[model samples]
Target: MTEETNGAAEPKAAAAPSQPVMQVLAQFVRDLSFENIVAQKGITNAAQPDVQVQVNLDAKKRSVENQYEVIMKLKVVSNIKDTQDPMFLMELEYGGIFHIQNVPDEQMHPFLLIECPRMLFPYVRRIVGDVTRDGGFPPLNLETIDFLALYRSELQRRAQAEAAAQTTPAS
Candidate 1:
C-alpha cells in the first residue's frame, strides 16, 4: 500500500522450468476397409490354400501452432492359398492430437511424434487383430514393429529411387 512498494515494483519470480506433459488427447481409427476381391466360387474352390500378407506403416504430422496431430496408418493385404486374389485387405489410419504447450525444446520432437504413436499403436494393433478374427478369419498376429527401422528403410528406398531416376536415360 505504501508508495515505496508499488504493485508493479515487486520483483517477479522466475518462471518454473518447462517439463514434459505425457498425454494422449484422443485415439481412433480414422479409416478401415476390407475388400475380398475374389468372392467367385471357382477362385475360392482352389485345391490348396496359401496365404501371403503384405504390411505397411505410414505416419504424418499436422501442426497447429503449439499442438500436433500425429497419425499412424497401417495396411495389410492377404492372398488366400492357391489364388492371386486378395482374401482380406485391411487399412487403418489412427491418430492422436496432443496439446504440448509447455514441453521443453529438447524433448518436444520425440514426444509429439514418437512417444504418442508408440502409446497408440498397441491399441490399434489389437483392434486390427480382433476385427480380423471377428470377420471369420484367423487372427492376424502382426510382428512387433520397429518404427525406427521402418523409417530408415523408407528413407533409403526414397534415396535409391531418386538416384535411379537421375541415372536413367531420358527417353
Candidate 2:
C-alpha cells in the first residue's frame, strides 16, 4: 500500500438538528355575557335600549425552551339595566402555543402582540356573535378591528398627551 494514502483525513462534524418552528398559530373567543339595559317596570317599562358593546384585546407570552405561548384576551361590555344594576360584560381569553426557534428578535414582539391577537380576533368575533344571540338578544356582530392602527393611535395619543403636559405649566 504505498506508504499510506493522503496522511489521515479529518473527521467531518455532525450537522445540528433543525429546530421547531411555529408554522401556524391562531386564537378565538371562549366566553361571553349579555344583559338588558332597562328591565324595570311600574313607571314606564322600556325595552332594552342604549345597547353599547365595547371591545378590548390583550395578549400575553410565555417561553418554553425555544417555543412560546401566546394568549389573547377579548372583552365586550354593554350598559346597565337600571343604572342601579351591573353592567353587561363579556370576557374571553384564548391562547395557543407557538414554536419560534431562530426567529429574529425584532419581529418577535409584533408577532406576539399584534399578529397573535389578529389571528385570535375571528374566533373572538364568532363567540361574541353566538353568545349575544344565545343571550336572547340579536347577535352582536362586531366589525373587524385594525390592531396596528389602534396601537399606533394609542401611541400617538400618549405622545400628544405627554407633549401637551410638558408644554403646559403645571398646576
Candidate 3:
C-alpha cells in the first residue's frame, strides 16, 4: 500500500491563533477651556473663519490587571480669514480607561494609542461641537483623525529629536 504524505514541517497557517481583546471601561473629559475671543472683542467679519487644530496623545498602564488609561489632548483655534481677527480658542483633554488582553507586549503601545482614542473620538467630537455652538458660533464638526498616521509621525518626531540631541554639543 502506498500513502500520500505532506511535508514534515508544520505550515504557519496551522500555528496558534491570536485573538486580541479590548474593552473601554470609562471615558470622560479631563479638562476643557473655551474662549470666545470674537464675542469678547466685539469683532464682526463677513469672511469665513480659518481654523487650526492640534492633537496629542498619552497613555499609561494602570495598577489593575489588564487596565490602562489613554488621554487625547486637542487644541483648536480660529481666526477671521480676511482680517485675521481672533474668533475663538478651545483646549480640551479627553481620557478613557480600557481593559485590554491578549495583545503582545510589542504591540501594546500602538493598540493603546490608536484604538482606545478612536473609540473615544466620537464623544469628544460631540462635546466640541456642543461647546462651540453654545458659545455663540456655528457648530464645529471636526474631521476624522487618522490615528495610525499620527502614531507614525510621533515616532518619526521622537527619532529625529533624539538624533539631533545626540549630535548637539553640550553647552
Candidate 4:
C-alpha cells in the first residue's frame, strides 16, 4: 500500500472529556426579620419555649445570562408550650446567585433545587443562629439538612399531586 494510504502519522489520542462547570456567583440575605414578641419578659423568663422551624426552597433563572437565583426561606416561631404565648418569631429569606454550565437539562432541576440550596444552607443557618442569639434567646443552631432526601420527597409529592389531578374531574 502507498505511504499516503497507510496510517503514516499515528492518530492523536482522543481529547479528554470536559469537566462539568458549576459556580456560585454570590450569596446574600434577601430579607430578614426577628421579632421578640414578649420583649423583656421573653428574654428574662427562665422558661424555655418550644421552638418550631420551617424551611422552604425556591429557584428561578435570572434575567442575566447563565445565572440563576436560589432562595432559602426559613421561619422560626417560639412559644411557651404550657401557656401558648408567643416568645419570638424570626423569618429569613437567603438567596444565592449561581452560574451553571455544561450540565445536562435533566440534571439541572436537581442541581438547582438540591445542590444550590445545599451550598447556601450554611450561611442561612449561621445568620439564624446569630440573630436568635442577638435577640436575647439562646443561639438557635440549625442541624445539617439532607438535600437529597428533601429533593426526593418533593418529587414524590409532585407526582402524587399530578396523579390526583388526573383522576379528579375538573370543576
> Tens digit of lDDT per residue, candidate 2, span 39-78?
3322332335344544444444554465566665555665
- Residues 1-171 of candidate 3 have per-residue lDDT tens digits of 998778687566765766998999999899999999987887763459999999999999999999999999999999998877889999999999999999999999999989998999999899999999998889999999999999999999999999999999999
Q: What is the C-alpha RMSD of each candidate to the true structure, in Å?
A: 6.5, 7.2, 4.2, 3.2
Worst 10 residues of 3 by lDDT: 9-18
Order by TM-score, highest first? 3, 4, 1, 2
The deviation in Å at residue 74 for candidate 4 is: 0.6
| Residue lDDT tens for model 1, 141-160 | 76666666665676689899
Q: Evaluated with TM-score, which candidate comes out highest?
A: 3
lDDT string for model 4 (28-113, tens) is 98899999887856355456688898888999999987789999999999998788788899999999999988777788889999
The per-prediction tally of clashing pairs is 2, 3, 0, 0
- Please provide the root mean square deviation of candidate 2 (C-alpha atoms, Å): 7.2
Off by over 4 Å in 1: 1-20, 36-64, 101-113, 162-171
Better of 1 and 2 by lDDT: 1
Which ranges in model 4 have alpha carbons more than 4 Å from their true place? 1-9, 12-16, 40-44
Cα lDDT over the full model 4: 0.87
Cα lDDT over the full model 2: 0.60
